[model samples]
Target: MKRKIFAGLAIRELREARGLTQLDLARRIGVSPSYMSQIEANQRSLSGTVIIELARVLRVDVSAFSSDDGVRLAATLREVLGDPTFGGLDMTQQELKNAALHAPKMARALVDLHRIYRRVEERYRSLDDALRASDGTVGSHQSAFEEVRDYFHFIGNYVDPLDRAAESLADRIGARSEDSLSRLSHHLETIHGISVSRHSTADGGGFVSTLDRARRTLLLNDSLPQATLAFAVARHLATLTLSDEIDAVVQAASFRGSDASAVCAATLANYFAGSLLMPYQQFAEEARRMQHDIERLATQFGVSIEQVCHRLSTLQRPGNEGIPIYFLRVDRAGNITKRHSATRLQFARYGGACPIWNIHEAFETPDRFLVQVAEMPDGDQYLSVAHAITKGGGRFDAARLRYAIGFGCELAYANEFVYSDVIDTRKSSAAVKIGVSCRLCDRSDCRQRATPPFDRRVTVDPDQRNIVPYQLG
Candidate 1:
């Protein structure tokens, strides 16, 4: 069974652009006016013969009907619209489609403008009393990093061309062997004329992998688990093999500077590595079969739990999309370390995550999976699972940073995940009330409220004190 491709909006746009009426184009294409109307309105998918006739009569390439440009533009527009500063400004899907079809340049311009606005706002957000007193310019990379994050986020965190190319490379090199790391190393050394080496100890405490381009040697930290070592090698191989594909995405981003472009490039290379480790189609099937058990998927793919969870979030490749999920990582302090969403649940941009969320508790119980059915202020519910992950500090004296990784989807998708089997998501009393963050939350009765919301009035009582003395009005 093949999925149908409907280009009603594209057909209508092309016909109107060519100064042809629906009936006129229908007659020219040898189709009924009613049928043409249905096609133009996207009420019907065009057949092969109809597409050919449409191309011949319209005197335009058939690609006009199957342009990914419209899809990309719509994605950018959606990201631009999702800015918190543009809260309450809603646009319908039809309007977004029209904008992509008819005013792509304008749509891009809006995205660019929003990017600039966010950068300026970020500078202000980072400005402190000391910086202001000293008249020093704020030096924050949040804007640039957030731009790169937004680029991946709006694209649904999947780079199809790179992903497919990686899959092909994996197939060519026979990467499906039980000994994945050995096979991958052999492929790199034989096919790409690159030698793989490992560092006795973690280099500089921060660098995971480095490539000496002149020597053509890939150096990996020996301390990394086999999965991470293989991933590092895969990332380097992707840079070598898929440079053009990765560069194309970077070019399309129109990043503000070389630093931002470099970040985008690194992100894409990592995406390729993840996709290579877990080929999209096979991984999606296995995930569904395993009920999205991260540990099982990790063991099957010979990857880490974090790697499995991250790859699961990228299963949004159009027709092959898996269960839509949101992936979030936070430090013990509740600062969001990494966040991506394929669902409606969005993380806070400027502050700590909500205190009531189980991700916070994950820090207390390291390596133990915590499950919760949490309800947001808007009444949206999710089945969240979180566990703490510790990285680095192979030696006892070295610094060990602890972070919690959380991934979940809406209640509608609860049944599709393994963790939700033991929990009752349908019970209203079982749901834990949560919010985006303390400052952005409006839950007045929450005992865990840390601070007053930005838009709400606070009544401070001098004499009264309950769970909190301040009333959010």
Candidate 2:
């Protein structure tokens, strides 16, 4: 077998990112300047020894050079093109890949343009209140938020360098126990010279967290769960310690607007926080041992169920990868408030989620986990579990937020999930048929379909008696 070489362009990117000239890097790797130039230009492949040496000199993970940036860009562009608004555009996957590989800058520009178009369409064309919320006067902020979500989705929700840093931070804080809040608090107070304060919504007026730089005090919402409170502290610590690393990733992303850039910056900080709370290797092992049970994982880590689910989706660190899961959160109205997928499954980007999805039923059965074996029109099956998570409203008059969280992986990995115990994995036909959304679904016989598929035709017969008012063809 021919030994696979890492991306020469990626090596060059890392070299330049480290401010090392060709001769400087060549000297560090014990190679000739000409050889280094040839390797960067893809004229000559770097040997295994040199790749290891390059990583040592660059002070970066080997995966930095291993990944094909073009492939990543192509995947993101393909998802961008998959937007329903661009439904009629005739483009092949190969063409999209070529465009991304050969003209990456143009590909990025196209993505930015498409995002702008989507915001415009949502604002001007739709009359719904949700549309107003997503594309109101604060359109740019919403677009930036959506862009950040897509960024995580395309990258498989894992950031190796930040994850490693968080792991190291956890070790430094001596947070070996499942209850890490006290250790984390000690580290923040002693090592970082920051004081932690507590307040409630009734007292703080709904502020979750506030950092006073001058006073070196961190005010946290007392009403928050212990896990959430610890998360706030961890996130603040990450912001203080990992600013440069997080900023570096955000800068490398080349976000088109400052809003997007800021959102990404905050997201990377959160990544660090999540990694710190659930150190990758240990968390991945526990997840596998527990058969990927989110609730059990929550108890083991002393975190919230939602936090456990979110962290599960981010376990895609190359050699230590865990189960790839897709997570979705929706409001009572079926609007997708949060979505990220490590699987091939893509959520709807334009409108509400499909009503047939079990996530909607979660609201009716609050605090109860509902499991389903759902299959898409493309024949891809998933074992999804959902439950309604209520927040706040502790008092009689206080406001509450109710949202359903759903997550799952493909049926091929069904045996690994605890929710799959009740599912008959032997019968593929038993999966509940679902779709991305009403506008994209094409099941003519679906009794729950709310609208005709965008690409299909529908016939209405006044005299016809059926479950629906019209027949889809």
Candidate 3:
């Protein structure tokens, strides 16, 4: 099925930004002014050819008109509305989707207000605990983190200026060469007059890397893997070399506080470091040749498997875009530590993931990749791959961190993935039914549901019971 593009607001904003009138854009894209007006008014859907031409004329990626934001927003709205407080409203899916598409700002404002309400409610409930612990107040760190996360999420997770700058720097520093690590160290020492040194675990104070600006020295943990060492160096270099680009992004974001701004800056710097290490064009081409085999990409780029998966999610480079993959990292407790999706498979923002998803199962088997074909309640199928990664704990006294890294694309593009060959994509029966989370899920017969659907009434029978204790009505 083809997706209908109703990107009138986005197109109008871009045209105005570029100082182009409707008639001017119409003439440029070989369409009549009246037709362009309809497109802007969202009275007509944009065809594939027209979308491409509009992208070319507007100097934006074709994905600018994608329905991803609308879909993600609608899903979030659905989850928000699933709360029992809104049960009396009885909103429909189409109405929520229209709100997402046509009144996005208002929809976002509602989501934000709901988030604030949730936070306040949580804090209120925990006030007694906080008083007993003498903590005084709940911190705003999570709020700042979410603000930064959503900034990247809404922008499609691609920072073009920083990415290009990193790519250029990579070429200059010979990022693809075997001696890249040495080259990076040399570049920092020579160009920035900063000396790099490795320290034992005890001397490094449990930190992976630390910069002493006054002494012009960088201290790296000796226990870290070579890949991590290189990444640390590259990240520092990005902060030094791409400060202007990073600042521009931070300034444009208008984050709520200095904390969010600082977090966004660090994240953008890390993004630049990843781009510097992988070099977008070269990495994308090699990824295609290797069938996106995470192990091979990790080996080729001298990076960790987790890094490879994360980088794969950021390959949304306009006309040269790679497969739209969703990547996430989960700890042993099933809390998602990292997440990004260029696909329609958005993860739950407020709770744990579906228990039936293979990512949670990845913890059972170490040092191996697990693949699954999953069908969401929305009927979208995906080919997912998950692998567990253990980091740190090189010494007996040090603690080890275990996380499962998962990444996948839709089944339509499953053939492009190496893991897809082992699964029968054609068999609908093979696809395990899953949902984002139990609270917002509408699946009535799932025995593995940890919680009842929020929007549904539960029926308890004294006569009999099924695998699940209560039936959803």
Q: Rate the local accuracy (lDDT) of all candidates.
A: 0.80, 0.80, 0.88
Q: Candidate 3: which stretches are off by over 4 Å?
A: 17-34, 56-61, 128-137, 203-205
RMSD of each: 6.0, 6.3, 2.2
Ranking by TM-score: 3, 2, 1
What is candidate 2's CA lDDT for residue 428?
Answer: 71
| Residue 337 alpha-carbon offset, candidate 3, angstroms | 0.6
Model 2 scores a C-alpha lDDT of 0.80
Residue 9, model 2, lDDT: 68
- Score candidate 1 by TM-score against the native: 0.78
Q: Relative to the unseen true structure, what is the C-alpha lDDT of residue 447 in candidate 3, on a scale of 0 to 100?
A: 92
* Tens-digit lDDT track of model 3 for 407-452: 9999999999999989899999999999999987889989999989
lDDT tens digits, residues 1-473, model 2? 33345366677788888898999999999999999988877667667788789889998766566534555566567656666577646576668756764466799788778888888776676566455565544467788898888787656788889999998987877563567777888898998899988877654255668999899999888776778878888889888988888888888877778998999988888888888999988889989999988888888887888888989989988756788898989999888888888776778776788788899999999968999988988677899899999876445655688899999998889888889998787787678899887766768878988877766667999888788788876
Question: lDDT: which candidate is best?
Answer: 3
Off by over 4 Å in 2: 1-109, 122-138, 176-178, 201-204, 393-396
State which candidate has the highest TM-score. Answer: 3
**All candidates: TM-score:** 0.78, 0.79, 0.94
